[model samples]
Target: MTQPPAAGPTPPPGAGWSGADEIHDGLPAAPAEPGAGGRGLRRGLLVAGATAGVLVLGGTGYAVATYVSGGGNQPEEVLPADTLAVVKLDLDPAAGQKMAVSSLLDRFPSLTSGEDDDDLRSTLVTPLLADNEWGLTYEQDVEPWLGNRMAVAAVPDPGSEAGVAGVVVLAVTDEAAMTERLEAVPADSFAFAVRDDFVLLGEDQALVDRLAAGGSTLAEDAGYTEDVDALDGDQVAVAWADLAGLQDVVPLAEAGAGLGDQALSGRVVLGVHAEDDALEVTGLTRGTAPTTSTAATEPTGLAADLPADTVAALSVSGLGEALTTSWATLQESGIPPEFEEQIEALGLDLPADLGAVLGTDLAVAVTGDLAAPQFGARVRTDDPQRATEVIDRVAGDAELPVAVSPLDDGYVLASDPALADALAADGGLGDTEAFRAAVADPDDAGAIGFVDLGELIDEVVAQGGDDAAQAQEYAALGALGFSASTTDDGGRFVLRVTTR
Candidate 1:
């Protein structure tokens, strides 16, 4: 198992954690009006007036609480830390989602070493939980307990701003009436929910990619349609909404740092709306927690200075053209709308020629040459319809003939084979000093990227081989474009070569 990186190089206490869960203030909105019942409306009016008075006259009104939950329970397919390695996501949610599934599908085991209880809570968890509008903010941090099964539920305050990890939400319209809603949930049902997922960026990039494509799937989606008993090693956790509800959080037996060590604390905001559904949940922060286990002091080579710009840069950073060429591989998969949004949200830049290839919703813009790959996905949608529209727009207007087709649950539209053949037949890869020179210049530093020799070798091997290993290798290639072909027995391999 790979060991955690040294603490000496860790990001400053506030580095990656600062914006982990940031909910921008001032989204557009207007004051809610009273409800339908004359008596009830009068009561709500009085409360709103009173709350407003406390704010204007008293000048010490507490913040309104806010929380968000995924509409109902969304099914989850996961590989917790126990079964495999933890996967750190790009601060971008969609990108993180793709990275999660990709890491699992690729087969990288969630190694024992990952963001440990303390590190996760402080760096990755605290900000997410505190930033939410739940009105209860704690600095305690929380992380996924590698070996256990867990679930998470969050009850948000009706009128506050906050951030969250992975949650769906609805607006609440009633404030005072919420007492009934809170009372209805079984006291036991509000125990605790574990938010568990894995990080696949392993010490070895190849190992990480292999796992993303074919890792062991530990937790299957529970469907959440009916009450299901907890699986072995599973824990039932409760979610919290307003300050009144959260007040009891610490009092719960299973509350501190958490049983599995995946807990972090942050601030929560609240809102008291006239209607029960008008309340909005804004952020989620993990709890800052202490642990008993002695952390592994061994260090990995990964740098700890993950600034937003740097992190965003790493989102595109790689060793060679594989990233630049990722369009081909991405083309091979279905366009998951949510994944696309991640790319756009990362705010990566796009090259005109390549941008034309990926469409707008999601495009892997390659920056380095054949060696060092510095690439980023231009993610743009959570709606598949939007993703398809983007594909249509880009492929439809391409200067070259674009062929659109589905593969492995996703879709890819690429330059016509005939056009590619025309280029190949004309010797695009041979005697083309300009292309080779440009591809070899990633190390110029003065240029867009500095290439790495290792990536070049990987690309060559992938271009010649068609085995599972080669397919896996192609994923790590800086260029994210290509098709991995394997023999029936999965022995023979041929990676149809292409570039973004």
Candidate 2:
């Protein structure tokens, strides 16, 4: 449903791709011969080496291949047109992990469950390095080529080392030493050529040359540029994908209806930023939706009405409108007949009842311990009497898991009658400190979610009869929350975790 963008506007000054800025001389460009073990083998080694470097560096690794230097900041300029996906990661994994562990210690000073930096390195990094030969020079060779930014492009290929289309990595780094190291590598083992400061690593020398030539770059893609730049530039990292190109590759027969038309064909961008003592991961994506679906404003005091002990809560608005809109489109597209037929086969009338059963705004919350979970829902409908009839009818026929009860201007659906009654109580979640601390900007959130990880872990521990290890792992989590809102181009979802 998302129409691809036309040609992108001119890139702002200094906003060009990194690592490919300057032209340089190195090994003569050669045509990559098919079935030669050299290209494929070297590519495989490069990938493994890069992955090892990231882990060894403790998450400071760039997403794709690189020992960067000698280029502008726009690494994406090197990506070919057939690129199926591009990913970028810029987090200092070590710092992030340290922050998370320290926060966990602050929350549960007595809980001795999580691993320290050294322990993590020994347990995770060392073993992975030991298993791969490329790990030998990961520190000296691979790590030096990377800077704070890196981008990887996945392209289709039949002769790649992985027996699929090969990938390319771009990063900004000083390449003198990197180039020397590559020259020393056995020519029969690997193939690579340095172009100025940019190091292109892939299975095919010809493809790599084409990449260095800078024809039809991903940077030239207007839609991708718009989506990636839309994210906060200060993010620890950023990433984007070419869903439309991918849709073209996979066979139509293999792609089910869910993965077929209306399922995909657009771009997605993701970013991560650390702020307010919370690490936020944000994403913007437009695959099937034609336009941003606006959310109705949730009632101000909805959370305040919940039980004080409620450990988790979520509030979503505009569902009724979304469903109705989707249903209409489905009808126009000839999908409703099949859907209706399926519903009828199951002795149900979905088209006649779905809209009447659900409300425009919905709030669901969880209370009690993990051993005895309690759930509650509040649905705001235009006609409560009709909603009650529909709900009661479903309950009578055991079509639903729980009965729905009428409440003030809405309906309460819960796991138990007592839980429903508790929801109807006068108090709400907004008055609670935990809820306030978890949500970042509740007033503007189209959809909001909160989790008291400490409390949830307590429930997990209570229910852990013999799985002490699993219980301990849960203890490392403190509290987390998320907020969703509509953006001009697409939707933005942000997740935050206040580590314990």
Candidate 3:
């Protein structure tokens, strides 16, 4: 963190700050430039605002020590049941969680650059408040009142033009100090009310007052509770959005590139957790569009059958059925007629011919040295000859530099014919220790993705630069694995990075 230049004596509380009126009208406008410290303060606030925006769309940290001893209350317990979206960060986690976080941060030195302390106040908050014109140091102002947990939520606001208002919930250790801190800041956009150990901040007094009243909270909503409960492991941070409610706040059809109504009728929840050796992020959705195909419930085995030397691979089941189902859904949703004409112009049927080419199981793999890599696509087709004929027709006079050949049960398209022959001869990717350690429940997954990092790490080390040292940190990193499967209601996915 770059230190800002020294400034004159600190201004009196709420002294030189401007833009208080903007809080009532809309978002707080940038305060009038005061000195170097003031400029730093402005930059910090902007960055914080941008992070909040991302949380509202996608969905960190702490005042640590206070909550670790006696875990803080969950933010959802206090938020309104009608809240559209929420992002919460837990600073004080369990002992194992602390280690996982530290180990993960060690992998990337830049994030911890110029920092000597691990305490959140020292390493994070202090830097943001270091040279503010208000002369407010985290130690003197924030640390005294800040607690361990914080969250931001989007709630319905009939009075707002956007039809939604933002709410911030911060855990407080000292209500009096928290009150003084708020008064010291000239901004009035944040009308606040204290309830128990937490303070609710909103655009207006009515909103915070409503939260304080707290009749039916989000914790009582069955759908929200189910999604959060589905997440495995103890979470360090969590984000959730009600897709149906979000559509009203954000234009889902345009934003999601023509998503159907069914797609926007679900709830999405994302959780971050620290494992013994790896940090994991899990996502789950419920009550979304339904697919009748059961092929995704069974493993394809195409990936495991790839050559043992494969460095990266992706395998997906039920592509054919999924394609047909999606096309039918799109038609029902009223796709532009021109889109269908474009497909016809390409000399292909809507889904029949495409489905045949993709087959039920599809896997793509990369092998050999990085300088001379080989790529192969394997498709499990009932009629290999017909699939080959379609490939030839698609290639037509283009004279593509690839070969199509038959496997025991399917067809393989390879940039190198020898690679295809190798696949037919032998495959042991499933037997590799790295693969076994990385992938989980491969036999039941709908989709699987994997990458062996050993060779890639070596290649980076050979280059021998500043990055070489950083790459070395990943030496213990064996591979990365991803798996997705359909659930009774919707779908679930997990991503894991394993270390030897």
Candidate 4:
């Protein structure tokens, strides 16, 4: 077969970064003051502080990853005040207690026996603890204290040798005498258990389960434990606790030299351990508080339960009755600005019907499914490429890395220098496959941004580049978007632009 053009582009791929750049240019520029990207930089330093507030919008349904990247304090409400219930990944009595995860498991009667008593974390438990929401003072505060002449905590050293991540050793001392020793260690760094009443709310459990399973010593033998109530209409809260235990409960410290007593409470758990390993249970103990629950808000005859605030934000008026209300309710309930803006931008009239009243909107969670929203929702863009990219971003933000996906409708032309720089300069980035490879292999410069050979070729030909003939051979790259960036790995593009 006559191969494609001698100076032609590579085999043509499906689509490229065609429309996104266009959309970016056409849409009103976001306020330059600050936003998700700005806030993201802040999140890196302090665990829970926010210097400023920023909002980033993507094509996802809503409430995906536009969160505080800094440790500064800002009053941005992530959830609605009237929310039925807020579920937090928890561990202790069950993998899902709503308190300090480490403490909860320690007090959990049934699963205590299976516990190594030396290790107290689950996969889900660690990440949440690392976040500012939980209020950990520093990394040392979360680390297990080993035995030393004195440790970071104020407890009676449980043993002589303590371990974490399977490394390091410390000396355990008598609680009564170690005051002098404990004084040397920074009280806050070693005082990991300082916050006993810590609590958090999130939407993932399987992830917690995975993390919990990774620990060497099982938190508890919670296989047979029965749920007091069905999870169907309940809000789970993670209970926190220490990975190890104290001498008060066991002979772990016989010649023990003290098992490092850096203890934990029930408010910082990472996952839920519901199954009761009958072998390790003790009698039931009273709990600190009652559990939380929620039920789907059935329609009250209005077309929709739209949030007033979100409605005000969108400024959609002259709308049908039921839909207006439903949308209003949703907006008030932490409806993402990106989603609201897009919906309003669609200019789609709200349908006045029973279905419309009872919001049939689709909601996606990183690790859980939102059974229903009081309003109807759909993943706006059905483009697999766009959808996958969005999902990957969400997962990554949450610290979970999903496989790469295709270029999406949003990966369009852009006049913005920041976005262009993030996309990088490989000609093959405009399409889905190249994007998948890029996101999948971020280390490789070629695989990171705006991939798709055909798209690049199209851009090159449009520009009538000196190497125009060679671009035809790269038909697989697609059309090129004029703007490009070397920002990712710190390289500058010799050329970047869209076709005429």
Clashing pairs in 3: none
* C-alpha RMSD values across all candidates: 26.3, 13.2, 9.4, 27.9
Candidate number achieving the greatest TM-score relative to the actual structure: 3
User: How do these models rank on lDDT, best leading?
Assistant: 3, 2, 1, 4
Over 4 Å off, model 4: 1-173, 185-271, 274-326, 329-347, 351-500
lDDT of 4 by residue, 112-209 (tens): 34433233232222444443432332122223222211111111222323311111112211221222222333333332111111111112222212
Q: How close to the true structure is residue 353 of candidate 4, measured as C-alpha lDDT?
A: 30
Per residue, candidate 2 scores C-alpha lDDT tens digits across 23-119 of 2222222334656443233234223322322222223222211122222455566666556777754433335434542443343333333433222
Clashes of each: 166, 24, 0, 169
Q: After superposition, how far is residue 294 of candidate 1 from its true place, in Å?
A: 50
Q: Write the per-residue lDDT of candidate 1 for residues 1-500, one digit (tens) a residue.
A: 22222213323333233332342332222224744443233233223322322221111101101111122221123332122111111111222222322232232122112433122223323444443443223231222112121223232222334321222211122221222222223333222121223322222323333333433343342212111121111111212222223333332235442333333232221111111111111111112222121111111111111111111111122212323455565555566879677556643333333333332223222233333323333222223343445555654554435544432222333344332222222122212322222222222211121122224434445545332242332232221111111112111111111121
The residue-by-residue lDDT of candidate 3 on 1-500, one tens digit each, is 11111123433434333432222212222335744542233234323422332221111222222234545587888898989999988887666666665565454344344433345534445655545555565655666778877789999887777888999887887776666666555555347776667888877877787787768989899988988888887788889989888877776676774554544678888887765455566777778733333447667778888888888899999887777777777677787889777566657765777777888899899887655678888888776777777777666545778888876677889889898787665588988987886677677778888877655666656867654565565455557777777778787777666655
lDDT of each: 0.26, 0.56, 0.68, 0.23
- lDDT, candidate 4, at 270: 20
- Give the Cα-based TM-score of candidate 2 against the true structure: 0.64
- For each candidate, give its TM-score against the true structure: 0.19, 0.64, 0.75, 0.19
